[model samples]
Target chain A: MSSRYSWGADEHLVVQITEDMSLESNFKAMAMASDLASQQVDGLTDICPANASLLVRFDPDRIAPAEVERIVREAEGRLEGGGPQVLETRIFELPVWYNDPYTNETGARFRDRHQTPDKTDLEFAAQENNLPSVEAFIEAHSGAPWITSMVGFVAGLPFLFQMVPQERQLEVPKYVRPRTDTPKQTIGYGGCFTAIYSVRGAGGYQMFGLTPVPIFDPTQELPDFTDFMFFFRPGDIVKFRRIDEAEYNQIKEQVEAGEYRIRQRPVTFDLAEYEKDPDAYNARLLEVLYGN
Target chain B: MAIEVIEPGLATSIQDEGRPGYYNVGVPPSGALDLYSAAAANALVGNPSSAAVIESAYMGPKLRFTEPAVVAVTGADIPVLVNGQSAPSWTSLDLKAGDELSFEILAGGARIYIAVSGGIDVPLVLGSRSLYALGAFGGFQGRALQAGDVLPVGVGSGRPGLSVPEALRPQFAKEMDVRIVLGLYDYRLTDEGMSALVDRPWQLSPVADRIGFRYAGNPLQWKEREQPFGAGSDPSNITDAGYPVGSIQVPGGIEPIILHRDAVSGGGYAQVGTVISADMDVVAQSAPGTMAMFVPVTLDQALEARAEARARRAEMMAALS
Candidate 1:
């Protein structure tokens, strides 16, 4: 419950929920951001909830900086009652082609910056986490669902945290030096979070796979992005389904023809219910997504 | 009527005040880097501050007007030209049909704001005409102007001869002290590192752009401690967090990058400090090779600077009116 409130220059007020990253911290940050947004405070431009912090951007001309701090403090106080953090969100089945050639080529090109130069990113990550093989790592990665803790570092990119206990969470360090290039739609990993690169650009995360479906379509040509260009949103749940290269190509063709539709379903995510037994809660959520 | 692009300069894009409220979804506030200069240009052309304008970096574009218009240029110390004849900047100039507009070599500053009487008419995406090139959604065709691109101009009742006084205009400098309000993970830096941030002058690197302005300087030192769980092993790394516009992050503690208007919303690097709001325009004016000395100030001082900047804008508006 320890939080540090600091100024991000004169325009932004950043509230650090905790020094460490955890699901609870992220929930608190997201809750606070949601609460602040509902208030419609004047001068408040953006309310960004990150891994373990909440950043509020405002205009000093419309409202005083001290007033912003006071309002945020009041919002933080409301969360002290331990209200049920229930979010009615959507669950998406994102197909990931693990150890794909695209990412494999990218990983090979940047081996000089990797911790294990001789091994692929998937193999190195599997070894680092004590998994028997890359196959085992894929199961561990795709076994459970992940929550979109934050969406940033570029347009439409979503940072995901696995829905598992702390001890079971897979941890991996980023590249020794960030590669100058990372293929768009690449599923990369760093620290305890996995990210889907919405667009091709410079990245520090370890390349593990690539997704055929577009998470970010600026043209909004895809059906999933009909209403918005970004396919993922904060609080959305994602289940990564491992697919072969053949399936990836099939989906890619469908996507190019604008006939592809992402598998998704609306569901309620309750923090209290999840805390009791994450595995059971996830099971029920999956049933809701796939149950006919 | 429309303006035809004869030559696309270094990086010319349509920009306005910016798009806000969508940062939570990773959409940056893509807008004019130097808001003050853009506003001044708009004011000269009798356009509202929110009207879309052309923001050219390093070099200016050569444009041909299909019809009569009133235009003004501001921001960089570049000379405006009308059919090869030198025209005064900061003053609205009348352009006849088929009149060609261009610019001389940039003497100072890195960007120029060109505001036409009728703002560049473009469809508003997410409530903005500003371009977020990385996202490729807003502005003209969701990208920078290319050769032979015909840009539609909105209708207006703007008059020529309006001008911003020389005394009120911003002055560019080779060596400038950029004010910063240090906080947000600044505690991760050692005392010596903090001292070095403000004591030494950092040169602007070539990597400077809309996303961020990178500075070359001595490596900063981080406080010794075990890397926290979920945080990377790099001494300069922190748990991924939100980055405010103008936030300064030194990745690997080597180069400090000041995230600008088009910056990513969040990242893993520790943001040691944020440039004060009043000085972001100053940072925008800096070109490659400019020397910037980071100066830390208290919150109260930062607010005072913001108030002063607001007053200056008011004065300029009153004069133009």
Candidate 2:
């Protein structure tokens, strides 16, 4: 696929792989970012890979912008063969309380900006996707594992895309006008991606649920965040396990006591094998995650 | 030694050259918005350019020295007062124990930089003392200075009479022609919209802060087309992507916001252009109600401006030495 390269001022060089989001574009961008990081080009400050683009921030004084562009071009050329098909990553089980009170209250406050002001965010989302009920929508959402296409917008927030085929993907538009406040850990959906709000701040995405686990711990008070403050990273696989309010409160207590540990396992994801028989492959992956 | 905050002003926080290498993880390089002035303040106090300095917004903080120390104030056209006596800005001034440092009303500019001989001794978080207050991680207790807060000062042997040449000092302007390198999403805008962006003068909105500077002007129109899949329905919305520091994004084709030192790393709004690195300091100096016109330049021209800025900074440092 053709990519467009443009300058983001004197310091940042942006490479747009596609105008639309697709697993192909995401993988390509991620591969290029990984390759550039390994090359360790001098003056390179940040190499960020998004859903369909990569932004390279550099110190123009140490290395010319042209030189940085040349290195990126070379890396792109090297990946013409489609780069790596498999990623050695971790699958995390994230417990989410759908139709929770926190996000529901937040959604109510911002309903004036929503497309369906009379309906809750989950109900509107379900209606838009032609799902029979919100339960069916939740099932479709939580049933499939999703890959983290990017991590940003705020500290530790992850943008996730379902592993299912494009035809089966859940799609919903963002709010007509953005809200000035969003409760931290709100499970927000926009277009084809799902995002977990790592912090309480302004947001436009439709709130669907609230996760009890903290994806970001600035204090590093939690056991999972001992090594790093951010829990999500690009290329992580997330399986949202639906939970009730009781479980949510229970998990919150465990988290407050610093006893909660996220359920995760290391696994190698082979794209080619998954493409052959997605359902069978996903079943195997889920087995690997939950099996003793 | 420590400096006690008598009054915290509008918002005062510790800043330095900033923490780099963390942008990919959504952490912005939170630092002094105007690096040139911040560095000049440091030079006047015989501190390294990267040393942590106090950054005050709109209003200057009221500080009392706990011991004898050298200090300097730079950025903004504000009157500096030491123990209720007028002091020259952009020059080192000696303060004895119990000497109070304060400021008069701001004459121009939006931010001020205060540098002590020994840098503000806040414990560094992630390799820098700059405060990312939104994330609450870096600088003093991961927040802005509050009244009665005792800030520790590092030890330094700085001369008390050093001064920066007048020519090297920054001049805050009520109107500015901000240079930008357009692209990264300029294709999304129509030719008329592009022209309007450069032709119109936008007034800086009062919402300006460390996160971003918003400008109020006539809304630009977008070219009609089928919305790309997974991109939001709004004409200005693109799939969420990383936002470069100084990038300008106009949501709903209104009120373009230029992300600053404490910028959010990525978002759904389409950024049509980015302010050239050299002009970021100029943008930082602009106070509310400042009229700014966007001036687009080629990559080569942008680089030339960067070089000129670097040379000028070097000259300032040389003069201080």
Candidate 3:
């Protein structure tokens, strides 16, 4: 693909269409012409992301409204050559705990939604339900990678894409009622993607986990970009591996001690039941979190 | 030099040309509400056009200068005096070490700009000294100036000064029409929404502060959007996004929320229009209940108007000689 998209003063708007979001192949298509994409365009704004279909922005003096439209359309069309653009991948193993209780259908209201309450009677629900715990799933699918796209919505919050098709799920519409108050490092997800609410306020994503990393900084030189280079981009594929608390603490210790490590792992699943289906784990966990 | 406040007038803070170019990161450039008056005061004191100055609202504070310095008060003119003697607005004056500067409750206007020689010495955050009270990050700990705040003054004040137009001084202090550009989302409203923005005179809501001034009067309708809540109706993030300084975001409420300095960077509510950069200072000075009508224009026209206003300010800066 010709690299004629970047190095312009004109406003450009690029759109990344995702019929269902986890398709990395289409996203990788645009990376070929990214070199020409002006930082003035979408991902380069103090807020743009690294890999996305569209990059839209305007510099009124250098280009007009119409030019912005033309340039972005050109950039979007050059996606086929995007495959070679995938570079190094950076992986972060997030640590999560499943201590919260998942209520079962009982004598309470709204119990008629699904099956009889069989899962809630067991302790160590992971073992009792004869299901793979989040930790087991993560262990089997460990080292799955994540790619960075353009930075969009909120400050320093990068949108990391590239989920495996088998692992991908349609993002459920956000929760109708947002949590009145949530704390920072709150990990949650919608349909096929996951995110951590970096700071506290109101949020609607399904909350399944938490992290301790601070995503924003005010004292850094750039105060924006840092040691992290959202490595995953469009067309990248990733899996999530569950780690035990001990493993998590070890990684935390390693991170604190400045140890760097990386590896790639694919996901696997036994489809006998949702407890065994890899894709259904998130929904099950969410069911536990919200309680059916 | 420092302005010792027995009472911090109303709401006060340090502001300058404002920090620009960081909007995409969710940061709005915030500065004096009245850029015209702030620039005028800085120019009068021989400081750069971007130097920081005092922003006072409703009634200016009782500032007792702890050191001798040249100063000019512009924008709103509350009853002011130096060492018990009435001081002239817009003109530079040399105060002794113990000169007492004070202002009574305002008779008119919403704010006043006090620029001292060398400008207010607050450290620059994101390239401006203007306070962002929302995140509480910039300017005097990102809070309003209060009594006993000993703000540092600039140096090299031994040089002499200039004067203001004796005839035009009063007229310059008077309220006037402020130009604006309807925002990109302007068309998202009904004909009535568009009309109420300009045709109907809206009054400054009594609720005002460094964060922003909430406007009252005229319920604008969005013919295109259907919702029970104001700006953050359903189809969107609901109630998110940072509020840029000078944005008018209305929720489901009839009245509009006019954001000002110290505003959040992003917001989800619909913004009908932005108080054009040039008119922001004027907007800051509109007292509660003052009538305001927003006018719409294209981007190019807005740029041209801004350039003309900049040239006009340069002339006024030179006019004091």
Candidate 4:
């Protein structure tokens, strides 16, 4: 078996499908993790997939690390030349008020830690991406759908990879120093990924907007969060839909009243077609989420 | 009747074996940092290995027991006192009703474990009684023990007089060797960097906590390569991936941060290596300013070390039984 992974102590095994981030690597990791989970291997606690790899945590006493390596290699071999997997996923339309007041207040408080303290995070990101203005940057950001590459820095925080061509993807550095405070529900962007602050704590990502809807409800108050506190799982698709402050306020009210419902649709993701025609495929994904 | 907190120490929280199986959602397995010490305390008090215990940092909590309790204190070089009378540590002692328990300043190590006959009777969240303070779930009221807070204990089954052998107890050292099985992105580091990691002595930073232990050491260099797309500009950054407990990552190649039990499950930084399971408890015991030396070992050695640890625990239990 090929050695394409790393051992984390005796308790964890990480299988690196690729060295870099790409949709193909992410899909491979997802497929392998899904296959391993189906095995219901005893003593295995978690099978977590990331951007280009997956990590398995288990009781070493119950299942030897060597055995884990053997099983993973076998599963990886089985997935070679395998056809595109049909992934059971959900497409969510998230409402965002870009450059909202909450984020503006928090970002301004941590200006000393930012790269471009004089300009807002949106302005800096726009200029870095060569966009004419913040509005244009917002358009580009919301134009494409993003896949949930991983869900973990903190609970329910999904790292999203944009579904656009390499050149079209936006990139930005994190804060020079992380802010001690970050408001919950703040939409943030760093590197080539996007995320929402699930719970207010400490964060370094440049804040871009604020989402009115909740992505994590620890109380399980929302219907979508009945079974779990987290709304988005790994491999879920999300599209950022711009909303006006008025609509944001309305949604906020509904959320407070516990009557808000996140707009989402059940969908199946085909990786092969996505690799061939990313643009058309992304458009169809959005259509499935928002189309009548 | 239950234990009442008169004063919470630097940081006192309820911990057990930890809530596993939820790292995928970013929930860390918040438990006693020093598993051996915790198990020793529980064993002394006639509780199961997984029984709840109070994990204290730096200082220890002052508690008033409303009812008599069989108690034991383990970890760190701190004195255990009952109503101003010094009591022996690592040995079970019976306390009468209204007996007040307290501790002295830590002479060494960072954490101490206090176990009562009955475990802390807190509602289990996600299947463990350990405290996840970051998310405010599990443990006693989902937070650290505060002044005036009351903690009920579970009905314990074992009797006192059980103590681990002196040879079995962990020996605290100012300078220690922490073994690692390098991988998960050690390839990103240059040969010099890899050598620098094991060759130098690293001092634990003052900011060390449950989430991670930050160490100050020589800045290492990374292999030069065209930064990949989606990967951040930082030389130490990768496309965010799952972080294994005990994994070591250097954000700027200056301070090496070792992820611990409460660490985030996944992130973007390139991890250079992971501390072997046997030494993770040692890492927890090291106090700030203590020096640590990284030692590289093979998988077979790591597995052998783990087996030794299990055998040691079995020996302790056998001696008590």
> Residue A171 error for model 3, in Å?
6.8
Cα error, residue A286 of model 1, in Å, equals 1.0
Better of 2 and 3 by TM-score: 2
Model 1 DockQ, alpha carbons vs. true complex: 0.85
For model 3, residues A144-182, the per-residue Cα lDDT tens digits are: 334443332343343444333443322333344454544
**Stretches of candidate 3 above 4 Å error?**
A1-211, A220-292, B1-6, B158-161, B166-183, B186-198, B210-212, B218-247, B259-261
**What is the model-wide C-alpha lDDT for candidate 3?**
0.53
For A44-129, candidate 2 gives per-residue lDDT tens digits of 99999999999999999999999999999999998886656777788889999999888999989988999999999999999999
lDDT rank order: 1, 2, 4, 3
| Alpha-carbon runs more than 4 Å astray in model 4 | A1-3
> What range of 10 consecutive residues in model 3 chain A has the weakest lDDT sum?
A102-111
Candidate 1 C-alpha lDDT tens digits along A1-292: 5799899889999998987889989988888888998999989999999999999999988999999999999988888877778887899899999998889998899899999999999999999999999999999999999999999988889999999999999998889888999999999999999999998889989998999999988777778888998888888999999999899999999999999988899999999899999999999999988886
Best by DockQ: 1
TM-score, chain A only, candidate 2, equals 0.97
User: Model 2: how far is A233 from its true place, Å?
Assistant: 0.7
Q: Tens digits of per-residue lDDT for model 4 on B12-113?
A: 999999988888778888799999899999989988988999999999999999998999999988988999999888888889899999998788888999
Per-residue error for A98 in candidate 2, Å, reads 0.9
Q: What is the Å distance of residue A197 in model 3 from its true position?
A: 6.1
Which of the two, 2 or 3, has more lDDT?
2
List ranges where model 1 is wrong by over 4 Å.
Answer: none
Give lDDT tens digits, candidate 3, residues B55-107: 88777787888888888888776666887788777778788898877776677
C-alpha positional error of residue A110 in candidate 2 after TM-score superposition, expressed in Å:
2.4
True contacts kept of 4: 0.75
The segments of candidate 2 whose C-alpha lies over 4 angstroms from its true place after superposition are none
